[model samples]
Structure formats: C-alpha cells, structure tokens
Target: MQTSSNTRCCIVGGGPAGMMLGLLLARAGVAVTVLEKHGDFLRDFRGDTVHPSTLDILSELGLKKRFDALPQHRVTGIEGLFADGIHALGDFRGLKPFPYMALVPQWDLLTLLADEAERYPNFTLRMRCEATELIRREDTGRVAGVITHTPEGPLHIGADLVIGCDGRHSRLRNAAGLRPRDLGSPMDVLWFRLPRHATDPDGTYGVPGRGTLLVLLNRTDYWQIACVIPKGGAAQLRERPIAEFQARIARRVDFLGDRVNSIASWDDIKLLEVRVDRLPQWHCPGLLLIGDAAHAMSPIGGVGINLAIQDAVAAANLLAPVLLAPGLPDEATLAAVQQRRLLPTKIIQAIQIFLQRRIIARVLAAHDDGKLVALPGAARFLLRFRLIRSIPARVFGVGFRREHIDSP
Candidate 1:
C-alpha cells in the first residue's frame, strides 16, 4: 500500500546540506522533512574536515559547545614535504578562537545536527527512504513533492518546495533535467587506515612523493590516509601485489614503518573516483539543488563539506522568510540562492582545477618519468614569510565567501 504525507519543505538526501538546511528551516518554524536513503551516516572517507567558517556558524547556532565536546583531531596548519625539506604550506593559528580545522568523523557531525533538528516538532527525518521521482503539479508542471521507496512501502510526500542535497550523483538533478558541466580531475584517491601512537606526528599533513601525493589525517588512534594516483589507476594498481603498494607508501611516509602492512588485501582500501563538476542552473520552478548536487568538488583541500554547509546556511537565510509567508518560492526566488553561492563555488573550483592541472598533474607526470618534483614556486614564495602562510590558510580554512546564520 502507498502512504502520503505533506511538509512545508521536503529535502531529499540527509547529507550535510540536507541536514543543515532542514535544521535551519525547522528552527524558523517551517515544517521540513529530510529523506535519507541510508539508515545512518557511517560512511568512511567522507569529508571530515570542518573548516573555521563552519565552526563560526556552529557558534552562532549555539552548537559550538556541543561540537567541541565531540572527539576530534585539530589541524593547526598544512605542512608538506618538498625537494628542499618539510615546509609550512598554510597556517591556521591566526584565525583566533577556532584557529584549527576540526577532524571529527562526518557521521558524528551529522548525528549532532540531526539530534538538534529533532527537537522541533515540525522537523521530520526519514531514514532508509530513497527518493525515486518527482511529483509534479499537473496544471503548472511544477514540482510539488517526491515519490520515495521506504522499508514499509512506496510513500508520497507533498511539499511547497523540494531540495536536492543528494550529493554528486543526485537522482533529483537527473529527474529535474538539471545537468552539471564536468571539469576534469587529474587523480583519484585510495583510502585506508593505519595505526597511530603517542609518539606519532601531532598534526595532519601531506607528502608529495615520487609520483603521487599522500595525505594523512590524524584521527586520534588511527591515521586515515589518502593515496592519490592518476585518474583510472586503481585497477592497474590492484593488479600488482599489495606489498608493492605498501612499500611505496612506507617509503613516502616513513613514520608509518611496518604499520602499512595492515592494509592486508585489496578489500582494505577504497577507491574514490575524483570528479569536479557544477550545474549552470541550480533550480527550476519548485525545486532547488545545493552542495555536491550542484557542484562535485575535488578533494584537494577537503573543503567539500564546509562548502555544502555554507550553501545550507545561505539557503536558510534567504529561504526561511519566503517559505513561512508565501505560497511558494518562484524561479527568481530560487535563482537568488544560486546567485549568492555561485561566486564562491566558482572560485574554489577554479583553484582546485588549477592545482590539479598545474601542480598535481606535473607531480604525477614527473613521477611517471622517474624524475624528482620540486615544490611549486608559489609554495616556495609562501614559505619565505611566516605571516604570508595565512593567505592559503584563509582560502582553504574559511573559503571565498563566509556565510553567517541570518535565519531565525
């Protein structure tokens, strides 16, 4: 049997964007429902770096204390190994108050947001409910709701608005006929975990090795590591013996020592196909898209989650009032949200594209030729002055535009 329900706003995908938007809208007394295909947010290798801008928003929403209470690792600066030696790439010490990026697991952060949103009677979070298609108003052909497959049966939700927060592979984007332009990435990442001890490095950092770059996130007891390789390289890599991979990693990050062997088989590592793309148009008459649904970012600086949260904040600021008073937001009203967020998205993607093509591509090419790669000139210049490191820090740690919590 099919069931039906209605909400003021229905957000598909209980990701960072969906949860934050649902929470913010609910706080403003709008009835919002968030649908999640998964029963829980426990996926590994998801973006976990909560940047300073997001921290400031948490403080505004009075959730800063709760965030700080979560078990997390703090990254004060970005360091990288170069031809000369280890150099400081960016420093976050000057950002004051929340001077560091919090490396809390993404699942924990989502749970915190969900718990807070549940306090409002108007907010509903439906887990294991996969949005399958859009429900349209026959007269105007405007999106009015979504058809979802729940554990119980097929369910229909009628709403004044529908939001797509379903990440890069968004079904809603496809259903709405909205397409993203693909800006290519040079690499994919192989993710795995290794043990960390009291004597290990205190902060997260990266190593630009012979051909590939390695990023290590200090996750308290274990190191969540990303090994970047050329695009479409995972199959060839797995064909080789696992020990060969282990030896390459241990050689790059020597401190890992024998712990690299813990990656016993191919099953221990996960391949993330890196993609960069963005939608030229982010909305239609009754629907809007945000976060990875609108733009799939390269995991260069780990700014994906932070950028999505910023989108949520901006959406709430502009959307709450209209949702509360009006019949429904028109195309122009929805376009306004895209206009506000477009510049920042463009700026970040531009930087990521540049780095991928200029820096990352060069490094991998040099490695393929068995040649040594030197640090880029920009990095060398930034290393010359202590205060200058904060520029990139601000760019990555905060972002192009910082969104504040303006919605009640």
Candidate 2:
C-alpha cells in the first residue's frame, strides 16, 4: 500500500460503521484509512438483521447483488408471543421493492463491505492497528489526525478530518471530553445456537411461549436464539445442567421440547446487555463521531446496523463537497453533517427504546402464562395495519429529508 503523508480522512474502528464510511469516502475519491483493532471478524451472534432501508442504500451503491448472494434468511416480518401463547406478527411486504429483513451473520456483512472497499484505490484498511489518541492542532484545538499503535510502533497519521466509528465503549468519545446522555435501564440478552433438526428443515423456529428464535434459514443449518435474562445473571445460569435449561425453555414453549433431541452445554450461549446513549454534539472543529460512538440503540428492532449505514451515507453526502474543495475541514462542514443526521438518529433511538420497553419487555414477562391470547391478535393487527407496518420500514430506510432519486 502507498503511504500518503497528507491523508484526507482517517476512520477509527473498522466495524460496520467505519467500514461503510471508508467505502463511501473512498468511492467519492477521498484518501481514507481505516484502523481496526481486531484481527478478524470471527465473533458470533451479533446484530445481523439487514432492514429494507439499508438494502436501499446498498442498492444505490451497486452492492446489493453481493449481499443477496450470501447465505442468509429472508424474514418477511417479525412476530411476538405473550406468555399465554398469544402471538402478534408484523408483515413488511407492504413497504417497497424489498419488504423483508435479510438475516445474515454480522461477520459476513463486514466481509462483504471490506471486499467492496478493496476495489477503491483510495481506501486503505489497517487491521490489528489500534487508535490510541486523537491529534489536535495546537493553535485551534481542532482534530487533525490520530496517534495509532501499528506493528512497527507508534505512528501519527495526519488527516484533514477524523471520524470515530468505534463501538459503545468509545475511547475516542471519552478522550474528546464529549458528554453522552444515557437512556437508562440496559437489558441483557443470552444468545445461543441449536443444531438443526430433521423436523425443522424449513428453518422456522418460534412459539408463543418460547423466547425469540432466529433461524438462519440457509445452508448453515444453525438457529440463533436471543433470550432476555437478568443483567449479570449469566454466571448463575451457567452453573445449571443443560437439561435444566432445556426444561425451563420447554416449560415456556412446549414445541422446543419435542423438537430438541439433545441438550448442549451452557458454553453455547453468549450474553449481551443492550443500552442506548447519544452524544449531545456529534462534531467539534475537525472531529466527528459516527455509528455507535455517536448514538447507541437498543437491539429491540435490529436497527443498529441500518442506522449506522444511514449515518455513513449522510456523512458522506454532507462532507464530499468540503473534502474535495477545501484546505481543511471547517466547523461549518462538520456542523452540516451533524445537523443532517442528529434528528433522524434520535428518532430511531427513541423507537428502539419504545419497542424494547413497551413491547419486548411485555412479551417476555408473559412467557409463562397459560392463556395464549395476546400473541395471535397482535400479529394479525401489525400485519394488517398501514401505520404499524410502516414504522419498521421507515426506520429501516427512510430519512428526515426526501430527495429526488436523480440527485447525487
């Protein structure tokens, strides 16, 4: 790779947001370098749902074909079940060309983006490289680049603009002295995988009484289930036998008892505590924050990845002019990106919180009830109504401003 002493942009954290932003900026002819601390994308059970709205962005980028070719499941809608066995389903077909959410593992999606990024000569990916601190200009106190730990040693890469695409526990945000508002009450998720059964060949797995079962309805033949558990309670559950876990699950939803032939160890499960937080200001001078670094959303609607993609798109759209014509990234340009993105990001975060609190929490609490009346009716209503069905679609793809498709 060629070294550019005057790199135009430096993106920290090579997850979905950073990778997507790198690809977008590189395609726009900006010299961009992405720094990723991790060596590879091998982590299991992450946010994998690609909403229709994100698909629209991929289509615009001419990368949807590659995404569709991956081994994934096409989820037409989401269904909820009450403890009493009542179910509610939300159908997404009423939206646009692609109404369903595509269920692919997060690693696979990252690989696709990284591959596409390789095609752009201006894009550089530095894996196993950790960004240690931001480099601010002494005179103006504006961010100029980053101090990173490379294989060789500490290296300072100077750029016209710096972006933080790091995850929830963002070191850049903290180092910048930006105060983020926390939305309180984090929920934990226990993720586990089950082997495919002969009767479950079609890959559909869920019942009114059981927790959410995500079927990877492709050649993988693995199902990912996210069961809500008490925060910090995973260790206690790990002490129990595998059969006890299965029995507890069966008591809530009887279908799993008949379908599951054997019990597995607790090691198969992974836990995550979901929380939402957003910075009051997304930009300061030449510095900017994107994705989870700027706004973290709950996993309820599976909108985290989509929201990150949208943020990348919006940032690219707003920053292209400044990067192409300017001597430096001015405060006005930085503010433009935040002005265009903050409201939409807040709205999406709000929706995620509502779903997690009002809908998901209620469903999980009712999982042990004998009367199964709530699940079915809710499914029917969500599937039938225009207002309810549009919420997910809009969150997935639509933004604050409606622009003509012809505009750049």
Let me know the TM-score candidate 2 reaches against the reference structure.
0.86
- Model 1: how far is 368 from its true place, Å? 5.1
The residue-level lDDT of candidate 2 at 346 comes to 77
Q: Which ranges of candidate 1 are over 4 A from the true structure? A: 368-381
Q: What is the C-alpha lDDT profile of model 2 across 1-408, one tens digit per residue?
A: 433245899999888889888888888888899989889877887678787877877788888999999888887755544554333245566768787778888889899999998898988998988888888889988898888887777778888898999888888888899978998543577776656555553433334332333222322466666666544556777887777777766555455567444446676667787668888898887789988998887765677887787778778887776787769878787787778778887777777777667755654555443333344555566556766866655655454443211213
Q: Quick one: how many clashes does candidate 1 have?
A: 0
- Measured by lDDT, the strongest candidate is 1
lDDT of 1: 0.91
**Predicted structure 2: lDDT:** 0.72
lDDT of each: 0.91, 0.72
Instruction: At residue 359, give the lDDT of candidate 1.
Output: 80
The weakest ten consecutive residues by lDDT in model 1 span 365-374
